[model samples]
Target: MKKLLSIKNIIISIAALLLVWEILFLCSSYSKALFPSPLMAFYALIEMIRSGTLLSNIGTSMYRFAAGYFSAVAAAVILGLILGRLPKVFQYINPVVQLLRPISPTAWMPFVVLLFGIGDIPAIVIIFIAAFFPVLLSTVSAVGNIDPIYLKVAKNFEISGSAATWKVIFPAVFPQIANGIHLALGTAWIFLVAGEMVGAQSGLGYQIIDARNNIRADILLATIFVIGVIGILLDSLLKSAEKRILKLWGLK
Candidate 1:
């Protein structure tokens, strides 16, 4: 059963989809210009490769994604630790965070575009918005929920003052932080395309928009395929990294 659902299965599924797409393309009177088959899409992908646009676009998106994602993780983790330890501080920030968290990243596109002026900065800023909250809230919750018994034990060990936090609080917060980071990673990745599409001259999002405008369904399909694949790859990489951290921390 595992083998049945393995990489081979993915290939088979894609092959079946292509077969259906080709059959539909053949039967329909729709112009090829409107709806190209899978083969045409594959061909267009090759053309994109030859034109040197594919790698450049993909690289730009990945770079923007990395910047935003890393910024979110750094800010969230540090803030999460501080707020989790001091609920009073959390209270101070809570109202503003609550207000901002509900605002959609896409809704901020116009403002971001105006502030950053049609560039990578706007897209990067958007990604940061989309990712930071989940990790922040999760870390706060995790810290608050740390076992009281453990705190008592740390006190018994005379591990008081700031030393207590690094030794006890941070480790206790790890499981929650891990989960939050993983969730944030996926969320940020999804938002990359939407945020990037605003006025991007090049990137995966731009590639999709360009394809659509040109009526190159094959190119559009290929761009979608690339984006989906990249999302999956990034998600899997983060999950593996989290599991490794858990193992190293003896929490696995």
Candidate 2:
């Protein structure tokens, strides 16, 4: 019932948005170059499909996203677990991490490019930095916030060491970890595209940049729409996965 209601709500919301967009397009007589209508954007999307711009661009962006996001997740989880379990070591490293964490990923791009050159490597590195701290910080906080009773329960069963850590603590703290992962996912996407825009021969980000330079407003708007649609899809998938895990843990 909940799922059905959600689907219905989504449909109605989309319909309402489309109606508003159409109304705005008709009521405002601005040049299409200034504000391309939804219909124009749709046409532009179709042209993109025929021109093979959409697929290749989206694929390249996804490749960059995957590289950075997966690496960040792995590194963050390992670090989170270590810091969470060993507060003394964590405290030693926390100040340096906090200093670095405050720096914006885009601010690091120039250094990354100087170090790695203009290529996928820099993009991947930027995405990793954008995503890493959030996940790591979240994991540390999640572990710290875990119920003491859970640890006691594990001890009652004579569980200790790595077994206790994984079988007991990790599962219990999953909800918070999921939040970190979710944030990292979106942040990675943002950084990936921004990195791509800086220096890329292929990618949705580059496609939009190129279209803007060429004064193709429709194509530019279409690319923006594509970015938004893909972002929504990726976030929805992550949230769904989170929901599934929560249900598995009886925590949903």
Number of residue pairs clashing in candidate 2, backbone atoms closer than 3 angstroms, sequence gap of 3 or more or interchain: 0
The local lDDT score (0 to 100) that residue 4 gets in candidate 2 is 100
Give every collision pair in model 1: none
lDDT of 1 by residue, 1-252 (tens): 796679788899878988998899999999888888888888988999999899999899999999999999889888887888799888999999999999988899998888778889888988998999998999888988988986898899999867887888888779778888889888898888998788567789888888888788889888888888899899989888989988988978
lDDT of 1 at 179: 89
lDDT of 2 by residue, 31-89 (tens): 87877888888898999999897998899889989999999998998789779988888
For all the candidates, what are their Cα RMSDs to the real structure?
2.1, 2.4
Report the C-alpha displacement of residue 221, candidate 2, in angstroms: 0.7
Off by over 4 Å in 2: 1-12, 15-31, 153-158
Top candidate by TM-score? 1
lDDT (0 to 1) per candidate:
0.87, 0.88
TM-score between candidate 2 and the true structure? 0.88
